[model samples]
Structure formats: structure tokens, C-alpha cells
Target: SQTIHQWPATLVQPVGSPLSLECTVEGTSNPNLYWYRQAAGRGLQLLFYSVGIGQISSEVPQNLSASRPQDRQFILSSKKLLLSDSGFYLCAWSGLADTQYFGPGTRLTVL
Candidate 1:
């Protein structure tokens, strides 16, 4: 069965702190990976996405970046955090069928 994993389920950081979130998929190869941020009670916003390793596309211009180092591994990073960055971060992957399966997501709170 295919599965997705995300780390640091919840986070609390002061303003200007560095942030890193990881997501990986099992039982799949070269799937399309995506990063999304959702504000409380708001719709999901696409942050970044990758069709293949080292091929990343940004949908929103913000303080965050994403990298795909491996076929099934995607990483999201920020040099510094902002108060507006507080939200739910979700990692998802889709196979050839283009059906996205989301990970458990990380909740970020910036003070």
C-alpha cells in the first residue's frame, strides 16, 4: 500500500526562526509531490510542487521553498519564520492518475 509521512506533527517557534519540514512516500516511484499551506478555516494554498527530482515549481511567492532530492522525498524549508507563516502545512503526492494523497500535516505557530 502507498503511504505518505510528515514530521514534527506540531511546531511552535518565535518570529524569525528557521523551519524545515519533511515528507516522504512509500510504495510509489517518481510521483508528483506538492506542498500546501492552509490558514485556520481557510482553503489550501499551493506553495510548491515537483514533477521530478530537482524540478520544483512555486505557486505562491513567500518565505518558503521546497526541494525534491529523491523520487519520493520532498522537503520544505524556510530561512526564517514570519507571524503570517503560522498555518497547517500539508504534503501530498499523486501517481499517474493524478489523485493526491495528503499526509497528516504539520501545524505551525509563530509567536
Candidate 2:
């Protein structure tokens, strides 16, 4: 059985600070990892995705970036945070099929 884990669970940050969020998947090999953000009352927005180690694709231009350091680990980072960046962050993984398994997610509040 595969499981996805996201850290911090929740975060409160001031504007202009740095940010780092991590996601890891267990019992999977070379899975396609994804990072998504969901704003209040809005749909899920695809932020970044990785097909393999070091191969990342960005769906939108925002104040965020993602990296896949290992086959099962993905990290989302920001050099400087913004008030508009506050939202629910999700990490998901998928294999050959279309079904994606999601993590518990991290809710960020920037003030």
C-alpha cells in the first residue's frame, strides 16, 4: 500500500519570509508527483509536476517553485512569501492510471 505524507499540516507566515513545504510518497517507484493549490471557494490549481527526478513542469507563473530531489520526495519552496500565496497546498502522486492519491495537505495563512 502506498501512502503520501505532507509536513507542517498548517503554517502561518509573515509576508516576505521564505517558505518550504515537503511531500513524500512511500511504496511507489518513479511516480508522477504533482503540487496543487486551492484557494477559498476556488478550484484546484496545478502548480508544479514532475515526471522524473529533476524533471519539473510548471503550470502557472507564481511566487512558488517545486523540486524533486529523490524519486519519492518532492519539495515546494519560495524565496519570498506573499499575502496572496496563502492557500491549501496539496501533494499528489499517480502511476500509469489517471487516479491520483493525495496527501493530507498544508494550509498556509500569510499575514
Candidate 3:
């Protein structure tokens, strides 16, 4: 069975600070990795995705970046975060053999 792991569950940060979030998968190889954000009442927005190691695609250009160094490890990072960066972040994965599985997610608050 495939599963995803995300941490912190919640976060509070000041504007202009740095940000780093991690996600990892189990029970699959070369699964498509994704980073998404959902606002208070907004739908999920894809921030980034990775098809393979060292290959990342940015869906929306903003203050975030993503990377996949290992077969199952994905990371989202920002050098200088903004107040608009506050939201619920989710890590997800989907393989051609399976449907997308989302993690518990992290609620980020930027003040």
C-alpha cells in the first residue's frame, strides 16, 4: 500500500521568513509528487510537482520551490515567505497504477 507522510500539522511564521516543508512516500517508485495549497475557502491549487528525480514542475509561480532528491522524498522551500503564503499545504502522490493519496497536511499561518 502507498502512503504519504507530512509533518508539523500546523505552523506559524512571520512575513519574509524562510519556509521548508517535507513529504515522503512509501510503497511505490517514481510516483508523481505534488504540493498543493488550499485557502480558507479556496480549492486546492497545485504549487509544484515532480515526475522524476531532480525534475520539478511549477504550476503557479510564486514564492515557493520544490524538489525530489530521492525516489520517494519531496521538499517544498522558500527563501522569503510572504503573508499571502498562509494556507493549508498538502503533499500528494499518484502513480499510473494508483490514485492520488494526500497526507494529513500542514496549516501555515503567516503574520
9-105, model 2: which lDDT tens digit per residue?
9999999999999999999899999999999999999999999999999999999999999999999999999999999999999999989999999
Per-residue lDDT tens digits for candidate 3, residues 10-107, read: 99999889998999999988899999999999899999988899999999989999989898999999999899999999999999956778999999
Model 3: how far residue 32 lies from native, Å: 0.5
Q: Give the number of the best model, judged by lDDT.
A: 2
TM-score, every prediction: 0.98, 0.98, 0.95
Give every collision pair in model 2.
none
Residue-level lDDT of model 1, residues 11-94, one tens digit each, is 999999999999999998989999999999999999999999999999979999999988999999999999999999999999
- Misplaced by over 4 Å in model 3 are none
Give lDDT: candidate 2, residue 11.
99
Distance from true location, Cα of 71 in model 1, Å:
1.1
Task: List lDDT for all candidates, in order.
Answer: 0.95, 0.97, 0.92
Overall local distance difference test of candidate 2: 0.97
Tell me the deviation in Å of residue 57 in model 1. 0.1
Residue 20 error, candidate 1, Å: 0.3
Minimal lDDT window, size 10, model 2: 93-102
